[model samples]
Target: MHFVVCLKQVPDTSEVRIDPITNTLMREGVPSIINPYDAHGLEEAIRLKEKVGGKVTIVSMGPPQAKEALKKAMTFGADRAILLSDRAFGGSDSLATAYILSSAIQKIQETDPIDLVFAGKEAIDGDTAQTGPGIAQRLDFPQLTYAIKIQELTETTVTVERKTESGRQIVQAQLPALITVEKELNDLRYASLPNMMKAAAYEPEVWDVKSLSFDTKKMGLKGSPTSVSRIFAPPGRSGGEIMDGTKDPAATVATVVQKLFQQNIIMVNPLAKGGKS
Candidate 1:
């Protein structure tokens, strides 16, 4: 089995700032780390590799600095790392990102057949949660999202427990499926000394636009259909009125109810009766 995990380097959300003029994230002088959800996805991929005896490869699309995120993933026991970086890929929305990633994955499959693809349910910065499914659509692979646990897996099929708003669902899909995982899927492992040393010295293979064949119209800002218009903090909430009922408790209750009714916060039932028989 050969698995590929998609990872991303994102600015630490706690310290992130927005450019008021451009309405984009201010990445300069901010610390970057492997996306937390992607880290969990990487952990699950490594665990599967350990159980099934296969190789895990990590792929990322970013600038040269994003190689740091790939190296970090390597410390978790991925066999290889690939970085898709090029000027043409700048300002790519989720759609363009998915296209670029799909192209890179197709290239990887030329030599090694991929059995499974792993990705986080959403990138923290964007939170659109569309890239994984987009890649699956492009590759014609079965897509599973919000997977919380893996129930079983074989050479031909894989069973998973997926989280949904209504409840949990047990789903099974054939091989060569793409799974976008929830952070609840797995906990990250501490890398061994040897793996850490290897990661520290590893240099990921970088593939630019010239290295991959992709449509020029389906990349970068030109391919992005959505753009942020403006960003501003919400107005601060004001303090609410306090009702003191220490003296006239019953009268105060009646007054509060009357105020609520006047404000339309509570509706009155004219025909309803409330009494003990």
Candidate 2:
């Protein structure tokens, strides 16, 4: 299994700042980490590689600094890593991100055919959960989002359980499928001394638009379709007064319940229809 995991370097949630003028994330100075959900996917890939004996390649699209995330992934025993960095790809939306990542995957496939592509449910920075599906759509591969378990796999097919608001759903797709993983999948393992040493010395292969044989017009900002206009934090609510009910707990509780009843906050209906007649 030549598992390809798509990782993203996202702004640390606590450090996220948006530019009011451009609606762009203030990434220049913000600390970054591998997308949390992608971390789970990487762990799964590593586990699978251990079982089946194949290579796991980590791929990411971001600025030069993102190589740090790739190196972190390499510490977990990924066979190789690639960073797709170019000025033209700056300010890309989900569609453009998926396009760029898809191009990178295609390039990797040329060297060794990719059996599967794993991604996170969403990035904390974007929270769009659109890039994974977008890549699958662009590559014409089957997409299984919110996957919680890999039920089974074969040379030709893969079965998984996807989590939904209603319940868990079982889905089966072909081998070259794309999966957006959930945090429930697996916990990440600590890197051993050898793996850490390997990662410390390994420089991820950097691929620019030219390296991918991509036309500059179709690979960067020119290829992107969406743009952010402005960004700002939402207004906060003012504090409310707290009620005093220490004198008589039951009396105060009854009084509060009565007030809620009068306000129609909670109602008892003798005639409302779902009665077990």
Candidate 3:
């Protein structure tokens, strides 16, 4: 069994700020880390590899700096890491990103067959929840999203508990499927000393556009059908008005009740002598 986990590097949300001028995220001086949900997915992939006795490979598409995220994933005992970094891939939307990642995964499959693909349900930065399914669609693989737990796995099939609004549901699918996992699915483990050392010394394979067979029109900003027009903070809440009940307590109460009734926040009592049904 061979598993390929898709990972992403994102700005630490705690430190994220929007630029007043550009109306975009202020990334400078902000630290980057692996997308938290993706970390859980990586953990699940590692656990599955440990159980099935196979290799776990990690893939990420980002700028050169994103290599740090790939290396950190390696510290979790992933067998290999691949970084898809190129200027041509910049400013890609979810659709274009999925295309680039799927192309890279196909290239990877040419050398080593991939049996399963894992990704986070959503990225912290985007939260669109479309990239993983897009990859699955392009690869023509069965997709399972919001998977909360792995119930069972066999050579030909996999059963999972999928999170839903009412409750989780059990879903079974064939092998070579792609799954997007929820953070509640698993706890991330601390890397062992040996794996830590290995990660420190390891360098991931970097692939550029020339290395993979991909349509030039389906990459970068040109390929993106949508773009963020502007990013701004939501307006700050205004101070609440105080309803003082000192001067005329009864009158204040009546005024407040009337306002509530006018706004339909509090329905008028039909049983009241003067109230209409």
Candidate 4:
């Protein structure tokens, strides 16, 4: 079995800021890290590879500096890493990003047939959980999203437990499928010394727009239909009023009730049998 994990580099949300004039993310000085959800997905993929003898490949689409993210992923025991970077890929929305990533994955499939593709449930920066499903649609693979656990895996099929609004659900899908994983799926392992040394010296293969067979119309900003009009921080909330009741509990209760009635926040009916005035 071959596993492909789609990874991403994102700004640390804690330090994220929006440019006041440009209304865009201020990423210049912000620190970057592997998307937390994607890290969990990658950890699960590596765990599965360890359980069953197989190869794990990591793929990401970003600027040239994104190779840093791929190298970090390689420390987790992935066999191969690929980075898709090109000026033509700049300003791509989720739809365009999925197109580029899917194209690269197809190119990779030419040499090594892929059995399963994994991705994070959503990217924190965008919080749009559309890329994974989009890739599945383009690859024509069965998509299992919000996966919490891989219950079973065989040569021909896979059974997974997924998170739902009410509870959990178990679903089975054929091979050559895509799964979007949640962080609860697995805990990440610390990289070994040897793996860290290897990652420090590793150079991931970089592919540009010319490397893949892609429709030029669907490659970059031109292919993206969505655009953010503006982004701003929400106003801070005011503190709530605090009342002291330890000294006089009954007095406090009566005061609160009277205030509620005076403010028209409560009503009473004099005609009812159990009515209060």
Candidate 5:
């Protein structure tokens, strides 16, 4: 049950701003933290380790500063941490990012066969919710997204509850599966003094593009098929007339209803089914 948690360092929601020229996020100088959903994944991994007696490994792909995120995860009792950083790896889209992570996971598997891989549903900044599935696709592993709970795990199988728009679904997948977890999964535990001390002294294993025998064109911006042209706020709403309801409540209410009806803004739909109007 060697758990590998794929985490991302993201911009603080408050400090996130779009670059005018690049149409990309202005990530520089923004405070970073582990993706919230990934935190739940990390907690679940630690819990599994405690139950079954195994080690948890946390990994991330970002700029050098992302080591901060790895260190933070290490504080939460992860046995090892790794950071995949390289100048050539900058500006990677979800596909390219997943490719890099999948390669790292393969490298990790060479040393210790990975029983599971977990990731947040999506990064707050990207909000694509694509990387986890992408990684699972590349690795040829069964993927469970929006996982609420792991009902059971065994050497050959995994049963889990997944949250969906309709309701909870109980799903079973084969072993060596990848899961993209939701924030509602579980609450994180506080890091203890001993873990914190160890984490402060910990040095994350860093890997660059060359270290992975990566395809040059598929490494970074060159491999990314999508590009943001621009990002701007929606236009402000026009001022609306406020009905003078204070003068005569009944008259105002009647007038408003009459106006709405006249404008066909509150029409009764005769075709509505089940008498739902």
Candidate 6:
């Protein structure tokens, strides 16, 4: 089996800043790290590769500096790493990003024949969570999102436990499926000394727009439909009022009720079906 894990380099949220004029991230001085969710996805892939017998390939699409993220992944025991970078791919929305990444995966599949594709449930910078499903749709693969664990894996099928708002769900999909994983899926392993050395010496294969077959119309800003109008910090919250109920409980209750009525926060006949006379 061959596993392909999509990785991303993102600004550390704690140090992130938005441009006042452009309303875009100011990456000039911000430090970057692997997307936390994607780190877990990569860890799961490497664990599966260790348990069974297979290869793990890490893929990322970003600027040239993204190779640093790929190198970090390689230290975690991935068999190969590929970076898809090009000016033509700049300013791409999730849809165009999926197109570019899916194209690269297809080219990779030519020789390796990938069985499973993995990605984080969502990117921190852009919490949209649409790119993974978009890639699966383009590849015509069954997509399983919010995966928490791999219950089973065989030559022909995979069974996974997914996290949901209500609780959890176990789903089965055929081979050659795509899975978007949450951070709860697995704990990341530290890189071994030998692997660290290898990563330091490693150079990920870089592919530009010309390297892959792409519709020029669907490559960059031209292909993106969504745009950010503004980005600003939320307003600060005001402190709440406190009442002394310990001294006079009944009077305190009455006072609270009277305040609610005075503020129009509660109606006199809120449960009444008809209008108040």
- Candidate whose TM-score is highest: 6
| C-alpha RMSD by candidate, in order | 2.7, 3.6, 3.0, 2.6, 3.2, 2.1
lDDT (0 to 1) per candidate: 0.91, 0.88, 0.93, 0.93, 0.90, 0.93
For candidate 2, lDDT tens digit of each residue in 76-138? 999999999988888778988888899889877888998889999999887899999999998
- What TM-score, to 2 decimals, does candidate 4 have? 0.92
Task: lDDT winner between 4 and 5, please give it.
Answer: 4
lDDT (10s digit) by residue, model 1, range 78-123: 9999999999999899999999999999988898999999999999
TM-score of each: 0.92, 0.87, 0.91, 0.92, 0.89, 0.94
Q: Pick the candidate with the highest lDDT.
A: 4
Positional deviation of 119 in candidate 4, in angstroms? 0.3
Per-prediction count of colliding residue pairs? 0, 0, 0, 0, 0, 0
The collision pairs in model 4 are none
Q: Which ten residues in a row have the lowest lDDT in candidate 1?
A: 268-277
Worst 10 residues of 6 by lDDT: 268-277
Per-residue lDDT tens digits of candidate 3, residues 48-116? 888988999999999999999998889989999999999999999999999999999988888899888
RMSD of 5: 3.2
* TM-score, prediction 3: 0.91
Off by over 4 Å in 2: 18-24, 245-277
Cα deviation of 104 in candidate 6 (Å)? 0.4
Model 2: residue 151 alpha-carbon error in angstroms: 1.3
